[model samples]
Target: MGERPVRRSDELVELLERYAKEDGTRETEIPGLRFIRASRITEPVHSVYEPSLCVVAQGSKEVLLGEERYQYDPASYLTASVYLPITGQIMEASPDAPYLSVQLQLDMNQILEVIQAAEQAGKPKHESGRGLVVSRLGDSLLEAVLRLVRLLDTPEDIPVLAAGFIREIIYRVLQDEQNAAMKQFALLGSRAQRIAKVIERMNREFAQPLKVEELAEEARMSASSLYSYFREVTGMSPIQYQKQLRLQEARRLLLSEGLGAADAAYQVGYESPSHFSREYTRKFGLPPGRDLQRLRETLGR
Candidate 1:
């Protein structure tokens, strides 16, 4: 009798366990792919989820996008087709089993290349959808992911083979049932793509005060249309999105650069320290000073 095939999930768990030794994200030799392992349940982590695909091989995670909550496990994967401010927490983990996952950042140029080469069907016109999505994982997709992970063991083979494997993985994602949304996200002139451009500008200029009319003009849409489409893609108005980005950057400055709360606020374009403190407290459930203290304590810094 033939030997039984190894389950994809099992293979992924083994590969990740062998490679990942720490509790944070580890950059692999393969460009755009990272491995994450955490040994214990974690508090909510606020960060930007870039255009990427995240797959869980063990344990589960919950991600909060605006008012929406998405939970995924070994049987599902999360895809963010645009930059998004999000809160994520590991829902299930422990010392023995831990949480193992892989994050592959998506490249728009590569996605467009695949679409053009395949002559893929165009997406039908529809209302803009949220940029973040969770889809059930199929066996074929899981197999492709496993192959990509396996390439790490042979670093010499990576340069020549990684690109083709990565392309195949993305092709599998494009073939998912949610392909319509993905296609819209990549199409050059779609409203979603237009809104994505506006988001790019916001990220670059997040420290500045927002100008809604100017952003609408940049997107070539009416102010109201920009508002609607922006909210549809990001789950928040442009002002709210900018505020989130500012606050997140302020927190990073405080923690990573050892800046004081008031200085951090000023650095992120907040004019009133009191107003910044209030908003920071409201968003993070702790004042900036206390939050920074707790983070440092937890990180053993």
Candidate 2:
């Protein structure tokens, strides 16, 4: 039994390496699951992380959430229990052993269902914690993940079996020592859950001016309490969080829509082109035009 999980983990790594043949992210036939491959270390990529589980089967990666840096490799897994703006980089890779990983987006409803079914005793009282966490990956969880990935090769089994496997994976995560953080996302009315609602509102209305009182109301907390809890979970104040979302969207506009700096800035709710440029440079380490050019060259676009 001990050897079985190790063998399964090896098999999982081989399958991920084989399927992820290119140097970019790829979506599988299964919903909410994606694969990433990188033949070399990558530059920092800024984006919002949805509720998801990220497991590296080979190599290593790092994610920057607010000012905190989280590094993980094959021995561990990263989880984002809420939507968060983050910077991610592939820290180790090579042509001989490319980085291979899988990201599974979490469905909150499914997570709640798993928790209910388990009906575990003495569930911990919810406490505020960062939504992003790295936890030691255990053999049981790895075995369940291996089974889930194996189904990709046999597409016919996916419809009937994928849900069960995914549920098992979530169950494993919730039962782990890091369950407190995961519970924030699953338990109703937890501070993390309340903040998640506010985050959703921000993402949906990012272009509009932010009002802390409105956000506080949305989260059902007083403004001061909201500020403190928001900072606790996200490592940033409400305004800073909104700025990250805006800047990330502005970058997307520049790259995907081919918008000029000023245009992208205004489109994403920045009123001052120069102000936007300053913040953009500060966040991405390059002025908007230069950053876009570099990204284009790197992507060969």
Candidate 3:
């Protein structure tokens, strides 16, 4: 009898574990590819998810965007159409079988190239949709992802072969039945793309007070329409979205710059230190000082 084929997900776990023994996210030799490994379940981590395709080889994860909750495992793949601030937690993991996953970041141009080349170029365009998508994994996609990872073992081939693999991955993702969201993010002047433009501006000017009317003008939508489509795409109101950015930046400042609570709050646009402490505690489950202390101790930094 012929030898039974190894499951793609199984081989994926072995490859990731061999390359990423450390229990943290690491960039790979292949550009735009990343490996994440963790031996145990971790606390909810507040961060931004950029445009990328994420495949979990082992364990499960829960991602919270606003009130929406998305969970996925090896059977499903997750893709982000645009940047979103979210809270993610590992729901299933252990030392004996750590959570292993690979992420390939997507560029807007690559997705546009696929959409233009494929038969979908003539499809009727839609305006807005959610930014995050979790869908069943197809065998072809799994095979393409595995080949991309396999390239790490042969560095010389990467110079010539990596681009084709990455292109194939993007092409497969765009070909999926539920890929409207991806299109909205890539097509010029799409409502979701317009909202994404507003989001980019917000990320750059998060420390300043939000001016919704100005943003609406930039997106070329009425203020009320912008509110509706923004919520549809981002799962949060514009105010809530800016708050997440502010809080995440404040956390970054406190840890990286050793800024005091008041200093960090002011820098991140909070008017009152007491208010900042309360809000930070609500978002992070601890006050800034305690949270920073716990994080420092955890990292021994």
Candidate 4:
């Protein structure tokens, strides 16, 4: 028989929506990840994106990681090799066809294991590149993802079998054109890992005052070299990274904790409420108070 016809995009869309409605209507927790189906506009949000892979079966989304922008659709997939603060919005969704997608959270141990396997298989030397990348989907990668999504249909078998399949899914990604970039994330002593270490420190203590010299010491690099490597790895300076962390936290406090703008600023390490207001407005496209107001109204808080 001839090769089986590839599934049409419409069929993929249907499968995604079906799984989404089942898993999305109620928050479903998988062993190592969380899955949700969302359509409404979200708050200007910033949170550490653990090493994870996100596939959008329908709709479009934009993720702002520091100064860098990553967008994905059905034809592409997004991967984050390290935990980083990222701002995201569901840019395309509607009542007629709400956003349909699946996210698989990654464990560092699993990633490290994959790295070892790839190395043993004589995978090419991992290239030096950013910790995050968006690449056109490969047929093998897409098929593997489709299989992972289909597992949701047989929830009974998920607990026992999902882990193995998830491993395969990641394996397919490693074989993609951009797999080398991801492999660098696995190499413990590589520059990418060093930069990831620096990011972990910054994320852990975003509220504390920062000294470039101190960060440089932690990363075992000179101040100037630290700046250069950090920017090269993350596409933003250390200070800008921290600022996104601060602003994202402040927004969360305002919306979730019901804190006022001034109080939120103080709590997030802002010395001047006005400075916080200016920066918050600049990044989020609205002042703190107004942004929160719109968020509450949009999300019906």
Q: For residues 214-237, could you state the per-residue lDDT of candidate 4 as single tens digits?
A: 888876879998888777667788
Error of 1 at 31 (Å): 0.3
Please give the RMSD to the true structure for each candidate, in Å: 2.2, 1.7, 2.2, 3.2
Lowest lDDT block of 10, candidate 4? 1-10
Q: Could you tell me how far off, in angstroms, the CA of residue 263 lies in candidate 2 after the best superposition?
A: 1.3
Residues 1-301, model 1: lDDT tens digits: 1122236678899999999987899999999999999999999999999999999999999999889999999889999999999999999999999999999999988888888777774665563788999998888788888898999999999999999998888899988866557767787887888898999999999988899999999889999999998998889999889988999999999998989988999989899999999999989999998998899899899
lDDT of 4: 0.75
Worst 10 residues of 3 by lDDT: 1-10
**Which candidate number maximizes lDDT?**
1
> How high is each candidate's TM-score?
0.96, 0.96, 0.94, 0.86
Q: List ranges where model 1 is wrong by over 4 Å.
A: 1-6, 125-127
Q: After superposition, how far is residue 208 of candidate 4 from its true place, in Å?
A: 0.7
Superpose all Cα atoms of candidate 1 onto the true structure and report the RMSD in Å to 1 decimal.
2.2
Name the runs in model 2 displaced over 4 angstroms: 1-5, 121-126
lDDT of each: 0.89, 0.88, 0.89, 0.75
lDDT of 2 by residue, 29-51 (tens): 88998999999998898999999
Between which residue pairs do clashes occur in model 2?
A: none
Query: Candidates sorted by TM-score, descending order?
Result: 1, 2, 3, 4
Clashing pairs in 1: none
**With candidate 3 superimposed using the best TM-score fit, by how many Å does residue 239's alpha carbon deviate from the native?**
0.6
